[model samples]
Target chain A: MIDMLTNILQTTVLYSTPLILAAMGGLFSERSGVVNIGLEGLMTMGAFIAAITSLSTGNPWIGLIAAMIAGVILALPHAVAAITFKADQVVIGVAINFLALGLSVYLVKFMYDAGQTPTVQKKLEAVAIPGLSKIPILGPSIFQASPFTYIAIVVVILSYIILYKTTFGMRLRAVGEHPHAAETAGISVIAMRYTAVLISGALAAIGGACLSISIGSEFNQGTVAGQGFIALAALIFGKWNPFGALGAATFFGFAVALSLMGQLIGLSKYVPSEVLSMLPYVLTIIALASFVGRAVAPSALGKPFEKGSR
Target chain B: MSQLNKQSTIVTALISIFLAMIIGSIAMQVAGYNPFAAYQALFVGSLFQAFDLGETIRTTTPLILTGLAVAIAFRTGLFNIGVEGQMIVAQLASLLVGIKLNLPPVLHMIVAVLVGGIAGAIWGFIPGFLKAVRGVNEVIICIMMNFIALYLSNVLVRNWLSEQGTDSTPKIPESASLRVDFLSEMFDSSRVHLGIIIALIMAFVMYILLWKTKRGYELRAVGYNPSAAEYAGINVKRNIILSMVISGFFAGLAGAGELLGTQGYMAIQSAFTGIGFDGIAVALLGANTPIGVILAALLFGVLTYGSQNMEHVAQVPPELIRVVVAAIIFFVAANISGILLGAVKKKRRAKES
Candidate 1:
């Protein structure tokens, strides 16, 4: 029983890392007023590139960096088309998703001549803290894990601080809430939005790296598996706050963890796997549908902030 | 001076699409394939052979409905991202109606499509109601609904709807099947059905609804400015909900087109069901107009159908078509300001001169 409890916690922690990172990413973009529906494609693209790069180079860290760069590269056209041109953000986002799906497959086919790239070696497997290794259950459970796990928690704290305490974040919040007010106050709304969205891209890349180099270590087309949408849901349920996002992300993580747990305790046979998979989505719908009051997105979420428009 | 809008939005979109296809063909030529031959083969593989032409029309039928589905909602300012979900739910509903009862042909057909639309409309408005009343973001809600719909379809297929012959629902009854292969046999190679005709009729209806009618004007007015519409006596909340219901109707029709026109039955895990997601692109590429959506769908059908031959003959992955799609979208999206800037510059230069 203790082991099962520990296992579920462990699984939750593992699953939450990527969701946490991606939700933080989503927080950055949506908070900046750019609705980034392309995050799904972005994360999937990063995971594919990271896995292939790590396998090709045999360096997981290098793969991680490459994935970030790859994510930025993919984000460029989307940003240009969306931010600069004043094209519909949602339309461009949808296009980017399809583009990524097609382009990644094309690249994979070109380089490896196969449907998918090889699995990565030198994975960022879980590691125990040396001093804490000797302690009992809680110590082992709490103290030992992948470096990314710790980074995820640290990032949550850091994201909260950056979004709330920093002048840069203040400018972003101002831009999102009211562009005219921010502009009058000398905030470059477009620049602020750019910064937020780029950071969104970078943070999402880390989530992709976690999936590729730590959690799964293989390049599959469906690896991201709609976690980007989960992150988006988290952002909304969190009301665009970093702390609320953390809670929502953890809920999804726990739901996913339960599915894995069901496999271990002989519950998998009774419950349909598809039904289990639907739990997170069902929970999200129920949360979203209740509609107690307006969960106002950033006033500028999908409206492209053009220079001279205001 | 207004040539851009003069040609109509759909024509402008088609021009971009043409440019993109040309670029793709050039890419093929650069990669050492015979561009002319490949181009010819692309057309022939999709339209020249009877089965090929059937495939093209079949693919186009769903696109027409899904494209209009997206176009209608976008015009109403609600991004119905759950069209895929709506379509899936409707697919299951249509299948149940298609396979379960022992009704006559015409009754079953109407029941299947109508039930499908009702299922979709019911599923689509959850987010719409939330958005209208609670101020929730409809896009995120719709997207979440999509995931749920997919899983729900899987569950339905596994537990209840599994056909006696296979792990899916029983094939549509002989009364319900829309196989047009009988016509194809006349040509010695075809599978086209009457679904394309239905899709065209729906597109026409949508055109009238969007441009000529009172409710359509209300929907459009709400899309342009909801607060203003409210001030002018348009019930913004009602329009929003109505927009979603209308959107679901078209999406459901897309599912109907698929089942009645081609697949002869419905199953959850059959395909990725990209028609809904792809409909967004189609709508954008088509400029969210009915005629434009039809052309865009047909063009996509050609590209997808032709690319299969391109893959087999030229060793180029059919995924190359995606590059064209992405590039066109990029150009359409990324170059908007550039083109506007150019037009502005041209006007300025004329003034200076």
Candidate 2:
């Protein structure tokens, strides 16, 4: 029983790491007043690029960096459209997702003559902490993880600190809450928003890299498979807080792990596997419907910050 | 001024399409393919070829309804991203009714189609109610709902609806089928059917509902400014729900068009048909107008239908068409007209000075 519990816990962390990273990215963007539905596409690009780079260079870290760059590059168009041109943020986000989907598939087909890239030569290997990974349950579950999992944990901590304990964080929040006021206070709303959005893209890319190089070890047509959107849902369920996002993502990850385990343990004979697979989405809907009204957004979230406009 | 605005919008849409084609050509060239030859093949396959034209129209049938689904929701200030989910649910509902019932031909068809609409409306109502009553973001809820609907439909198909040795339900009864003999004959025995006619009629109905009815005015008013509409005695909450229901209704019809007209049965979908996501592009390119949706759907139809020929003749990847569609969506959603019109007005002012 203890062994089974440890295994399940390990699986949960593995599943949640990407979601935590992406949700943290979403937290920064939304807390800074931008709605980023393009995380899905950004992750797709990251996963594809990471797989290709890791496959070629035989190094997952380099692939991770390349994934972040690809993400930022893809995000530039969204920034230009939503911030510079004042397009509807949601519409621009939808377009970006479509663009990412098409561009990645097109590139893959062009490069590999297939819909997916070849599996990476080097995947991010699990790191067993000295002496810690041997502990009965807690150690193995927490200490034996890929470098990306540790990085995701660090990111969640750093995001919380940056968002709640820094001057820049305060300014970002101010810009999100009231851009006009932020501008009156001499803050450059456009620059702040641009920075936040770019950070979001970078972090989401890292999450994508985690999926392709760490979890799946390859970039397929379904590598990112709505994980970005699931991360978005986690961000919303977590009320846009880094810690909240972490908890929500872990819960979703647990749900996913349970579904897999249930199927493995022959629970599918009793409860249909499809229903188990749907647990996370159903939970997200319930969480959103229950909390959205109470969990207030940044006052100026999704509104374009125009200079000299009240 | 309205006429000039309309003209400018059209010009901007054309420019966007032109830019996408240019980019697509460059991509083709980079891939060691001939762009002009690929485009020629695309045009011939989608337009000049008789059977392909029928295929284009056949593809256009579902797109028109889905586009209208998105368009109606957009006009009412709701983003119904769950059109795909609603359509899936509707497809299942239509399949169940179409296969289970043994009614006479016309009544059975109508009943199947109506059941699809009702099922979609119910699927749509959840997010709408959550958004209206609980202030949840409809986009997120809709996204979640889509996964739920997908899994639910998968379970249903696997356990209850699946025919022996196949992942599809049994063929719908002839009475429930939307295949029209004359229409198929007209299209050179292609898959064209009564669905296109129904789609066109729905477009007309949408136009009339949106522009010629008081409920539409209320919906639009609520969309434009909910607080103001509420102050002016419009039921904002009710309109939100109503708009979603209507949007889902159209989405349901889209599913019926596919199941009854094209496929004659529901197959378990491994992935989304992408018709719903494409509807976002269709609605945007059409400027959320009913007639514009038809035109935009036809354009998309040509691209998708033509892609096969492009692949066969020029060895261009069909995925390139998707890239082109994405570019078109980006340009349109970014308000290409706003920049061009501003440039044009500046030029005029300079000339006057």
Candidate 3:
């Protein structure tokens, strides 16, 4: 029973890492009043870039950087369209999803003559912290884990600090709450939005890289499938707070972990594995509906900041 | 003002398409393929061959319904990303009805279609109701619902409808099928069916319903400005829910048409069939109008069908078309033509001075 519990807990942490990173990325963007529905696409590009670069360089760390750069490249267009051109963020975000998937797959097929990239030689394997690795169940699950897992936790703390303690974060929140007021207070709403979205892209891309290099050994079309949206759900369920998002992401990851291990745990005797797959999505709806009491979005969320207009 | 806006939209769509083509050509050049040859193959494969033309229409049939499904939702200020989920649920429901029910030919088909539509409406209702009552974001709910629908369909098929070892359900009887002899013979035995007629009719019905009826006016009014519509005594909540139901009805019909007409059974889907996502592009390119949707679906259908030929003949990846489609949508969403028009006006003014 203890072994099984440790296994489940380990799997939960493994699954939650990407969600935690991506949800934090979403927190930055949505908190700054931009609705970034294109995280899926950004992540897809990130996974593809990370896999390709890692394959070429035989270095997962370099691949991670390349993935971030690729994410910024993809996000530049979204930032331009949403912040500068004042396009409908949701619509453009959907388009970006399609573009990212299509472009990545197209490039993969073009270069590799296959639907997915070749698995890289280098992978971000788990490492054991000296003291904590000697502990009981918690050590293997939490302390002995991938560097990306540690990075994800660090990002959560950094995000909380960046969003609450800093002047930049205050200005960003002000812009999201009321762009006109932020403008009156001398904050450039456009610039703030651009920075937030770019940060979102970079972090979301890192989340994707974690999937490709750390959790999974390679990248394919399905590598980043639906995880980005789950991250989005985590962000909402967490009510746009970094710590809240971390808890929600870990909870979602636990659900996913349980579903994946249902048969081993004897849960599949009652529910079909396929039916088990619906748990996270169904829980998300229930969470969105009842769990979060009046989770309010930013005031200027999804609205273009028109200068000198009410 | 509306007339000029309509004209400008068409011009915008054309420019976007042109730019997308240029981008596609550049991509092709990078991939070391002949753009002209790929283009030639794409056009010729979809249009010149009679059988391919029939297949194009077969593809267009579902697209029409899904496009209309999305267009109507967009018209009502809701982004029905769940159309894919709605369609699949309807597909399963219609297939089950076709297999399980014992009825006369015409009645069976009608019952199956309606059953499918109602199933979709129910699926749509979950998110719509949540959005109306709890103020939940429909996009996230819709996305979640899609995965659920996918898993549910797979589970249902595996448990009840599967043929021993396969993941697919058994094919339904001929009485429930949409296959007809004359249309197939005309198109060199392609799987064209009465679904095309139904799709086209639905497009017209939607157009009239949106432009002609008081209910549609109310829906549009709420979409345009909810507070204003509420002040004007419209039931905003009902409209929101109704529009989603109607949108779901169209999506359900698309699924039914595909099952009863093109394919007669359901296979366990590992991923989405992408018809619903493509519908978004179709609606956007069509400007959310019925006529525009039809035209856009045709264009998309042509690209989809022709891209396979481009793959076979020019040795290019079929995913290139998706890139082109995405570029087109991005340009449209950004209103790229407005900037172009602004530049043109500035140039003309400079010349006059």
Per-residue accuracy of model 2 over A63-125 as CA lDDT, tens digit each? 999999998998888888888887778878888888788878888888888878887868998
TM-score of chain B of 2: 0.95
Please provide, for model 2 over B134-249, each residue's C-alpha lDDT reduced to its tens digit, 9 standing for 90 to 100. Answer: 98778888888888888899999998989889998889988998887887787788888788988999999999998999999998898778899999999999999999989999
* Tens-place lDDT digits, model 3, residues B192-304: 88889989999999988999999999988878888999999999899889889999999999999999999999998888889998998898888888998999999999999
Q: Each candidate's lDDT (Cα)? A: 0.78, 0.87, 0.89
TM-score of chain B of each: 0.88, 0.95, 0.97
DockQ value for model 3: 0.75
lDDT of 1 by residue, B24-120 (tens): 7776666555767766677777888766777788778888888888888888888888899898888888888887777888777778878888888
- Report residue B196 deviation for candidate 3 (angstroms): 1.1
**Ranking of predictions according to lDDT:** 3, 2, 1
> Which 10 successive residues of model 2 chain B have the least lDDT summed?
B1-10
Show pairs that collide, candidate 3. Answer: none
How does each model score on TM-score? 0.93, 0.97, 0.98
Clashing pairs in 2: none
Between candidates 1 and 2, which one is better according to DockQ?
2
Cα error, candidate 3, residue A34 (Å): 1.0
Go through the candidates in order and give each one's DockQ. Answer: 0.64, 0.72, 0.75
Of 1 and 3, the candidate ahead on DockQ is 3
Q: Docking quality tier of candidate 3?
A: medium
Runs in model 2 lying further than 4 Å from the true structure: B1-7
